[model samples]
Target: MKSIRIDRNRRLRDDPGTGHNRWHPDIEPLIEVAPGEEVLLETRDAADGQVKPHMTFADLAKNDKKVGHPLTGPVFVKGAEPGDILEVEFVDMTPQPYGWTVIRPGVGFLREVFDAEFLAHWHVDGKFARSPQIPGVRIPEGIFMGTAGVAPSHEQMRSWNARETELVSRGGLALLPDPQDAIPASQPIASEGLRTMPPRENGGNADIKQLTRGSKLQLPVSVSGALFSTGDAHYAQGDSECCITAIEMGATAVVRFNLLKGEAVRRKTRFPRFSHPGYFAAPEWAAPHNFVATTGFPIREDGTQECEDLTLAARNAVLEMIALLGERGFSREQAYVICSLAVDLRISNVVDLPNVCVSALLPEAIFER
Candidate 1:
C-alpha cells in the first residue's frame, strides 16, 4: 500500500469529450500509489494555467485554450471491480493565494443580455476577495473542485452533453460490468452526448454545491480498477450556478477511496436532494426567512406534472415582481428565462404548505458569502 502525491505543475491534456482538460494521477512521473491507498493532488485553476495573477485580458487572448479548469487525474483504482461502489470523501480545499471569474460577451447563462466581455479578478491579499459589487461584501477565500468524476463505463462521451448521456443518474457512482459479462458490458449504454454542467452517473460536471468538503460521494465501478478522474475546480458558486462559471479556480484534493459491494442503491435521474430536519435558513427580499422545506414527489411516471407544478409555483412566488417588470416592459419570455436560469427549487416547509411550498432561491449570493 503506497501513497501518491501529485503536484499542481504536472502536464495536463484536453479532454476532447468534455472540451475540458484533465490529468491522470497514476501516470504522473512524480507520484506513485497502490490500490486501497490514498493520494494528495495539488491542482490548478479552471483557466488551466492560461490565467495567472498579473496576467491581463490581453494575455488571456493569447492562449488558444484558456486553461483554468484543470482536472487532477484519471487515477486508476487497483482491484476495483465492477458492481462495486467507489467512495470518494473530499477532505479539504484550500484556495490558492488568488482566484478569478469572468463573464464573457457570448458566454455564460445570461449571454443574450450581457453580451460583453466582463472579467473579474480576485487575489487573496490577506484573508478575503474584495467584492466589486458591494463595497462591504468581502468573501472568505475558499477552493472546491467544480468538476470531478470517473471514466465512463463504456466509451468516452462527447462534450456539451449531459453526464447522463451514456451513463447512469447524477451523483452516484456507476457500476460497470466486466467485458466478460454476457451482456457485452463495455459498450456505451446511451447515445446522448455529455452534459455541459450538470452531473451525471458518470459524474462529469456535477455542480452540486453539497459535494464540498466533508462529504462522501459514491460512484459505481464498471470496469477493472475503475479509472477515476476529477477536475473542474470552483472557488465559490451559487445554487443553480446561474453564471456559466463559478469563481473558477484550481485546487489540491486529498481523496480516500473505499469499496462497497452489492449494496442496494436507488437509481433515479433527478437532481440530488438534501434534508434539514428542523428549521432551515433562507434569504428574503426584506427580512431573514426561515422555513421547513419539503418536496412533493410526483406520482406521475414522466415527472411532467411535477416539473410543471414546480415551475408554476416559482412563477407565482414572483408574480408581483413579474408584473412590475412586465409593466416596465420586460417580455414574458424574458421573465420566464430569468426564473428558469436564476431560480433554484428546493423543498420548503413541507409540513405547513398544501403542496409543499418548494423554496426557490433567486440569485442570492448569500450562500456563497
Candidate 2:
C-alpha cells in the first residue's frame, strides 16, 4: 500500500508538503492513486500536535486554534472529477499509545455552564481507552477519523464564504477565513481558503464516530482529482462530542478509494454518506447491554420551555447525565468528560410538537465493578 508519513514531534505546518490545514481546490495533490488502491496516511491529532499528552489543561490557552485540523492529503484519485462519488473504505486504524480529551472554556455544547478548562490524558490500547484524570471509567475503542473530505471547487468556496459572511453579519457563529496559521501559507489560497471546522458538501470535519474500521464513507467530489484529505483521529467518542473532544490522538489510517463516475451528479448528492458493514463498535458497547439513561425535555431549569428545540433537549439530557454522574461521586468536570467519551445521546421523541425529548445513555459496562 502507498503511504504519506509525518513526524509526530513536528506540526503539519513544519512540513506543509505532506499535508494542509485548509480546504481549497488549488492546494495541489501530494500523490496520485488509481481506484481500489489502498493508501495509508499518518495523521496528526486534531490540535495539530499542539496539545501533547504531557501538557495539562492549563497549557491549552497557548495552542493556536487556527491550526486545528491538520489533514494528511489531497490524494489525487486518477480519474475523479466534479460530480463524482469518492468512496473511501476504511480498512484499518492504528492509534498511538496515548490520547487525550479536553474541555476548553468558551466552547462545546455546554460552553455557557462549563467555562472552566478540564483535560484527560488517556492510555489507549486496541480495545479500550483508560484515563487517570477521570478514573473508574474505560471508553471502548471505536477508532475513526474525525475529519475527512475532498477540496471544494472554487465556486463552492466563494459561495460558502458569501453565505457564512452573511451569517456572521446576522450574529451567527462561523469561523471565517483567516491566514495567520494556515499550513500552506501561500498567497491567495491561504487568505481565501475555507476553514475545516464545518462539514460542507465536500465533507470536512464531520466528527461522526461510527466511521470506524470496515465502514465506507462516500464523499461528493467537487474538484478535479477529488483532492481527498483526512485527519483528526479519535480513539473513541460518544454520539455527541458534548465536550468538543473525544479520545483525540494521532493515528495511522488505511483506506482504499473507489471512484464512482458521475454518481454524485446522477443522484444529486450534495453531502457525505457513510455505511458500516457490521457493528460500528463492539456489540456490547454499540447497543449497551447494561445502560443508565437520563431523559430530558425542552424544559429549562427556569421552567421555560423551548418549542421543539432538539438541540436544547440534547443539552438538557447531557446536563442531567452529568448530574447523575456527580451523584455517583464524580466531579462535574469529570462527568462532562465522561459524557463526551462514552455517553450516547439519542433522540427519544421529536414528533411531539412544542417539546422534543432526548436521552443520554451511559453504558454501565464502561465502569469496572
Candidate 3:
C-alpha cells in the first residue's frame, strides 16, 4: 500500500455560497490506491495558516472573506470503484501552540441578538487551554478538519447552496432523497453536493464535537476513484456549533483508508469508536438526553419498497423547547429553525436493535439562558 501526504498551499478565491470564504487544497491530483492502501494528509486550519500571535480583530475584519472555514484536497483515490465505501480513520491531529475562536456579527445561533464580532484567543500550555470565559473551565483543545469530501459525480452539480441560482445543467445526483426518492441512478452522486452546510450522508462538514480524536468516517464511493479531501481544522467547538467558527487553528492529520466492499451498513452510523482508557473530567454544563432513531427506507419510483429492511437510520435528540414549542405555540417551521440553531446531532449507537440509533442532544441552557 502506498501513502501520500496532502496539503493546501494556496487560498481559494471562489465563493463557497455560504457567505464565507473557502480555500482549496494546493496539492497534486490524488494518486490512485488499491484496497487497504492509506494516505496521511497534513491539513491546514480554517485561517489557511494566516492567524498570528499579535493579530487583532482588525486583521480579521480586513480578511473576513478569507478567515472562515477552509478545506484541502480533491484527492482522487485510485482504483476506488463505485459501489464501495471509503473509510477515513483519523489517526492523529496535532494543533499549534496557539489558536483563536471568534463569533462574528450576523452569524451564529444568537446572530440577531449579538451582532458584534467577539474574539477569544488562547495559548495551549499542554494539549488543553484554560478557559478564557470562566476561570475553572478547562478547554480540551484538539484539531478537527471542518470541511472534507469529494467532488460531485457530475458537471451540473454546483456547491450545496448554489442550486437556486444555478440551473441543474449537466449531471448531478442528490445524495439525500427529497421527501420522495426521485433521484436518477445513472446520474453522478457526490455526497458533498447534498447538504448546504456540512452534515450529509457522505460526511462533509459534520461539526460533531465527538469527532475530536480517534474517530473514523466511512463515506460511500459514488463515483470511481473516491475523490477525498479534508480541511477546516478546528481546535474546539461546541456541540451546536452555534457560533460561525470554532477554535480555528492549523492542523496536521494522518488519514488511513480502508475499503469496505459489499458490507452491509446503515446510511448513518456513529463515527468509528475510540477507546480512551484514562479518566477525564466531564464539564459541569454537560447533560445527557434520550436517543431517537428514524429509518429511511428506499422507495421505488412507484413508491414501493425496493429492498425490505434496508433502512438508513438517523439519530438526533429533539430539544424539549423546540419540540414543546412547536407542539404548543410556535409553528413547526419556526421550531425547526430554532432547533437547528440550538440542538446538537450525534451518533448514539450504530449496532442496536433493527436500526442504528443516532443521538441529538439539546443544551438546557439554550432555553433557560
**Candidates' TM-scores?**
0.61, 0.97, 0.58
TM-score for candidate 2, please give it: 0.97
Candidates, ranked, TM-score = 2, 1, 3
- Candidate 3 lDDT over 16-57, as tens digits, reads 211112212122344555555555555556665566667666
Stretches off by above 4 angstroms in model 1 are: 1-36, 56-59, 66-68, 125-127, 131-134, 155-198, 264-369
Give the C-alpha lDDT of model 1: 0.48
Question: Mind giving the per-residue lDDT tens digits that candidate 1 earns over 1-369?
Answer: 233333445434432222224222122223334545677766666555566667655667776442334455556676676666677767666666666655555654444545545455665556455534223334443345667775554334433233433445555433222222111111232123232234555565766555666666777665566666566666555454543655666666777676666431434322223222221232231122432121333323344444335434533444433344356454543333333223455655445433435454543333233
- Residue by residue across 171-215, what tens digits does model 2's lDDT show? 999999999899789989999999898889888888888888898
Q: What TM value does model 1 have?
A: 0.61
* Candidate 2 Cα errors over 4 Å, as ranges: none
Each model's lDDT comes to 0.48, 0.89, 0.49
RMSD of 1: 9.7
Segments in model 3 whose C-alpha atoms lie over 4 Å from true places = 1-28, 64-68, 131-137, 155-201, 262-369
